[model samples]
Target chain A: MSVEHVVSFDRRSFMKVATGVITGVIAATSPLAALVPSRAWAVDLGALTDAQGAALLAMIRTIAPHDALDSAAYALVVAALDKDAAASAAVKSDLLTGITTLGVGFAQSPESARIAQLKAIESSAFFQGVRVKTLLVLYNNPIAFAHFGYEGEAFSKGGYLFRGFNDLKWLPEVPLADSGPMPV
Target chain B: MAQFDLNDDSVAVIIGSGAGGGTMAHELTRRGIKVVLLEAGGRLTPADFSQDPGAAFGQLTWLDPRTQSGTWDAAKTSPNMPAWHCKTLGGTTVHWTAATPRLQRYEMEARSTYGDVPGTSLVDWPIDHSELKRWYVLAEKRMGVTRRHGMPGMPACNNFKVMYAGARKIGYKRVHTNYLAINTKARDGRGGCIQQGFCSQGCKTAAKWSTLYTEIPRAEATGHLDLRTRSFATRIEHDVAGRANAVIYRDSQGNEQRQKARLVCVAGNAIETARLLLLSDSARFPKGLANGSDQVGRNYCHHLTSFIWGVFDQPVYAWRGATLAGVVEDENIHNPTRGFVGGYHLELVALDLPTLPLVGMPYGWGRGFTDLIDNYRNLAGMLINGEDMPQANNRITLSSTGKDANGLPVAHIHCDDHPNDIALRNHARQQGTKMYEAIGARQVVTSPGSVATHQMGTARMSKDPSQGVTNPYGRSHEVPNLFMSDGSVLSTPGAANPTLTIVSLALRQAEHITKEMAAGRV
Candidate 1:
């Protein structure tokens, strides 16, 4: 039998449970959250002040713009940062250290100054690992940014989050037909 | 029911659900045997898969921000390189590049052709390539392996037109796309690949043939396979007789549960397989379960892969097709000229990520970014996937300091390429340089050695119980019904992606087990 058949097996049988429990608990519209304070986990962006969070969010936007292309990755990072206090702490420290080392103080820096500082540090090996890693985290998995229009979540709207198999490329032609920074 | 007293009561405990587990579950269940295929990862629905390279690495391969800081985290914790694996339901097959080239004739007989590498267990396969031919065809058919035929590059895909043209101009040996276990046409309900160019993340559409899409669901449909998602197997349980009995696993909630089975199959990836075996020690088999010979976690090998990139003068969207499309098999066989016993497959690959060009390139970001962009098209590159000779020193050992939440010893790989590995890599580099120059590359750069992503070879197969963990059928000689079906059973890390071979071996093992079960042997 296929997935179609299996999904249909207990489909309607769980609808009441889905609405009664799953929806009442984790659903976005759950009014129950207000009643159950114990259910609400604390979310803190540690080491990063609210101001720092805003500043980094803005900076990431410039570095990786979300014009026609997807910027959900950026929002996911912010969202993740918003939820996990400890994770945001490491990110906050890394970014602050990177920014300060590049001579751009957080509170005093202009938008242009911040961009310039980020760009300068982008070239350095000291910031290379952290910066690249941060981008990878933010862009690839925007779980934190699920609230925002994180495209990744939308991409997984159908349920294929970790679905298909990877096809191995045993043979490939060299000096490829085209090579350029693909459109973002 | 026959009134014969059954010694073994294993309903079915199949490990892994990639090529092997999937195929086995289908066969065994079809033959009326109840199966319990255990995968130590979450199950993914079709909609959960994506075609975005960025998302692929994020969701498919094992890199999540929640646990990205740890040493075992593939996201940030490569020993020294940018390699990783998937921890999701489809296993690493979710992130595999579905290349399915069969083992060459000599790959099965390397020890006979050349003397064994001193510290390495460079032995030939117990079963020859010919033995796997039918299974390879079955795997290819099941996975929807396809060919582009005459459309340029390797016949494997359409994306290699330009690279194929270039390789031909340079007189490099052009290889046809051998076989891929992804759907080119809808087979077993999976649609043909949409070519979203992001097979790595997981196929969002039911276009790609991951086990989650094909075998897992198929097994689930049979009512014979009991899949428990989020159930992480910590160790194997044995009867007082010291034979295989059950598996001890923990739930996502960190609570332990013991599931009994007469027989067990450890189908976790190579590292996890070896780690599980070593951790499942008993007084009777104190070295580890099925490790009486102490070869349970020995002879680990991964292909010695290295990358070479050249700046091209055109705007080829390397990310438009699957990340790879063409291959130069000029040196897939051992030759006296190359002075290496193993062969390497070269393929044109695009970094496929904007940040990949930025971060993957060896140079600094400024120069590196500009250089890569300036000749993105000209930057057609090839990676030499050199096969590593199995070395005992290059094995997976339990870390003295690290343990997972479940208290199982995490896998600590003591992997360092051998001198011959270095020599083989250098030879591939030289060959890549020559190929690049011949292909009219204005400026070609050969990269230093990189960590191989295709991890394999722990708990390898051999004819003798003294020399190998599993016999030729992937069943442990120490335990009558215990089995291994992942890359860990590979005798040698053949010069190809191991996903297909692992599946084929699993299929073969399933056949063997079914026949044995009929005779009441298992």
Candidate 2:
């Protein structure tokens, strides 16, 4: 379930119930909704605080290990989580709780233990959600796409006609045995 | 179209304007019939579609909170999103990979051919392949399906190339860039596919045959179709004589409006169609409308699917022309020697880096998960499209307590993998692994499988009313004016893709309805 779900399910009863049927309601969009990122357009969002952001970023790097990725790419994921937490205080609390518990002193832990710490929490809802979002946000970044040898320039740049559309070097040839027209 | 008469009962109200309803709108309106096409999502142009897979998923997906049960991985992997269908105006026509393979003859008569496997609800279609052949021709020609009637096939992409090489190595023939509805050389006024690679996530160009641009637009030009986007159908009301006469739906503004109908066509795909039937419970029809047979929400079939990715030593650049370009049809037949009654097709499929982790392995996280995404360009994929046996227990039922954004009870999709389905999937996955391994793939990853594509056979067609909901003509057995225009009318989930067959059935139904109306059959 999503963070909004966590908020609604947990907080539905706390709101003043309509005593004797007369009713009213109020609501607004979350804070940190601003922070529109680049053309790939992962929303630029703010975590509640810096340490929260740091803890989340540390968690993200562990999910997708990349020496090639800039520090900004990790920030892309942190921005999303921060926004997610901003929307739901419960998700925020969950993030902090997970970081503190899953981290096992992440700052001081050896590299192997850090990896092991992340692996322990991989199945948890927070880790899974963060991991899913990280994969989405990071790959959408054009810089990340470039590093991964994926160009979004297929049809836009001359339709892959002159480019390597038919190029498959490693595999064997599949000859056109039935060169005649396909049957209707 | 302007606000249609709320009281006018002449208009044929279609409850979903994607493949079936959109095509019906075009076909019926041209033949001088008024249609009120109700789509449960907004009408979006290509400008609204995002190229990013994640964004596109949010922009296009239904994302409704439907409870899932039984042992299908879809319940565990994508719990909220049971079926991967778009709620938008074009329906899943927007989300299709456009593989338009005709159903093989043996597939239509599964009961006679495959025989009865234990723990399955296998049955024959009311109509045979020969009965559907002429209609299939009309559908193929109209959609400009490649490799048919001299319309050329889509150019081979890197993924298709690798798939072909693998097929050749495995001593299998009949490998080709598919007879997809996507264009090679611009026909039907739509542009040829330049293939920006997000075929599963709405087509960027007007190249793919989504009704948003193709049939719906043409229907709009005839001035007989009132395409109401985001109008969710709640119930099918009928006359005391048991003829469907109206559709009660919540309009975009959340006001419930009952559109009086001369004929009510339920084409909201299988899940919604079945759910709507169950929700429309009445005093006369306690079970549901046109559900006297108790088969309105039974015999659900999602193609037994598996995604296998091959990580090669060199760059395959699988993300090229189309999302899916090639098919190995040699295995799309029943060879009982393979330990499975039915067979499956192995098609070349490619997922972007973002999609690979979430769907390719939704629950995994480790060195291996990172490695899969790290070598995205070097990966080639094969998706097994197997013929799933329809189980009476696997169905779309209205939840006892759970409700939707609207106060109506949500549709809970319950599916347990039949043993036949498991056998077919396992066999196909092994074959895919071997195919990849033969082509010098470093490692092969078999996904625990993912969300469904073709959802079919909830309200199936059969010779006996006790067995199925619709007859050979897709008309309801109980209600004369009600028709099932989507995959819900399908008796079986054939090995190949189901869209072409769905389109063919719609065309044939249109002709039958037209002729019956002329003769005053009702």
Candidate 3:
């Protein structure tokens, strides 16, 4: 299957979950009420409560904080965890226990306070699991790709041969003769 | 297209279809020999390959459960997945970054040159250097290696430019894009590389040499090859005369089927090749086939490997070229003054944003680790591929309890770094750090060794039957009709990558087999 197809499918499913969850949670307390106004995203959560999912997203951002990264990139981690939790009861329990152990006000806390809270539980299974999952889901997304300046797949666009495979303007130019003689 | 019957006892059965088996199949078939080729994984075309690292890993990697016990870093980091090889039709060739370097003349005579390093089982290869060189020339020509056959070298990418500047700053002269099997210009019916950079994900353009696109197709065109995909060879059955006459394996549907053979060639990589031999124990030769010396699965060597990443102030765009197109060859000499017996090569490497964070750095959270990810565009990476000492204790053995899907015991890999290996790694790391520092790198991070890609030395070749598993021709000392046509027959692991040598040896072995068959020896 094509990578574009897989990525679009993930985006479609996440949008479906986000619309349903936001509608259901709006009547009660908004789970994103604790997050910063500009950074809050509409996330689709299945096994986690709105509060737990919000706290999980906050925890992932704290683990690998990049101010340039969009909040939607961090939300991908929550969506992936929620999907896994829906399929496996063990995953749901781990996410619930880990979010609860981070204690209340984790989503509302400042960056420094959140970092301090995560440091205490860094050795715990819940923390390690979250750290690994965040690396897998957060960094591989298109939003993260843009923030990090990584050009994804090149074959569809005719590869990088003409585009910038050797376009390093900062480095000194290497002599063509240094590459040795060309084939006859 | 050739369909050999189950009872076609005149056919040569080759197990596994990577560099060794795949090349052997084509060589034998073109010579009008009937062959049955068994592959454990399904066939995949260039269209099936994905540029996504994680998705492609799942698509190509051999994920069979294998246990590991070793002092090597892989035991701690990649515990369950010890060696990284493919299970697909083309085997590891589908996943290899095509750097083809021949073994040095001195490297072939390890025992004489190194002077018997204690705690090691090093031996000189039975075949002389000149004989191997003759085959190396043929292998290079057949694979269309860039530097050897007057083929133009690959164009340097941003990653290679960074490496070139740093290496030059460190006063290393013998540095270039290295000899790659990827076509620089359209040749051998394969297109020239566009430098897409995800080479390990299976070259989508078929520019890089892989048996899947090149050798297997050519062999099938000969109409003398019966290529069986998803046929896992479980045991090499022999008659009372101790000749390997049949192979019992599981078909695509997991049904037990036997394919009779005039002779057998096992090239299932070092791990599985040794396992199959050990599993084929019989009443006549109880120790195992060709294991009277008890050295079937010993002296396992996965080259001393580590990734060194240089975080520069400006963008380097490391992931825009051929993944392993640059090399430093000055260190590939045997100099005891460097505090190591054998030597190493520093090849330019690049991992995508997703894989870089996972395997490129140590496992840690917070700003200290995230900062590396932040400067992903400015990262220049190089990998140390060095020769490691061959120890008798470091080996692959069958697990007593663990069983595969077909109810056969799994291969357990056990390795511990020899003191020489540790010393060589330290020296290489120091030199690598110096290279980057000379070019004013902000920070140099040495990542731990990942899963082994250059695995060798499990079933070694020796002049005497008492010392190793196979003879110089990769033929079993006891089972005359049984041969090994892979990196498993390397008596010692050299500093260079093993693909070119594996293909060369298979080519040489095929000629011998043809001569022997014509002489009515079998």
lDDT (Cα atoms) of all candidates against the true structure: 0.61, 0.79, 0.87
Which ten residues in a row are the worst by lDDT in model 2 chain A? Answer: A18-27
Docking class of 1: incorrect
TM-score of each: 0.75, 0.91, 0.93
List, residue by residue over B1-522, the lDDT tens digit for candidate 2: 635797889888988887898899888988988889999999899877876677788888888778889898888887778788889988999989999999888988898999978888889888978889989999998988877898777667778777877777888888888778887776778777775677877887778888889898988988888889889999999888988889999999999999999998899889989999998889878999989999998999989888898888888888777777788899899889988888899988888776777677646655656887888888899898999889898999899867998898888889999878888899999888888888788999888768987889988999999999999989999999999999999999988788898899999999888898889874
Give each model's clash number: 39, 1, 0
lDDT string for model 1 (B242-335, tens) is: 7787777776676777777767777877877888888888788888888888887788777876667755544344544555545677678878
Tens digits of per-residue lDDT, candidate 3, A41-96, equal 34555677777777888899899888766566676787777888888998888778
lDDT top scorer? 3
Candidate closest to the true structure, highest TM-score = 3
DockQ winner, 1 or 2: 2
Give the worst 10-residue stretch by lDDT in candidate 2 chain B.
B360-369
Error of 1 at B438 (Å): 2.6
- lDDT, candidate 1, equals 0.61
Error of 3 at B158 (Å): 1.4
The runs of at least 3 residues in candidate 2 whose Cα sits more than 4 Å from the true structure, single-residue gaps closed, are A1-48, A153-155, A172-184
Better of 2 and 3 by TM-score: 3
lDDT of 2 by residue, A58-112 (tens): 6777777876655455666676667677688898788767767764457455657
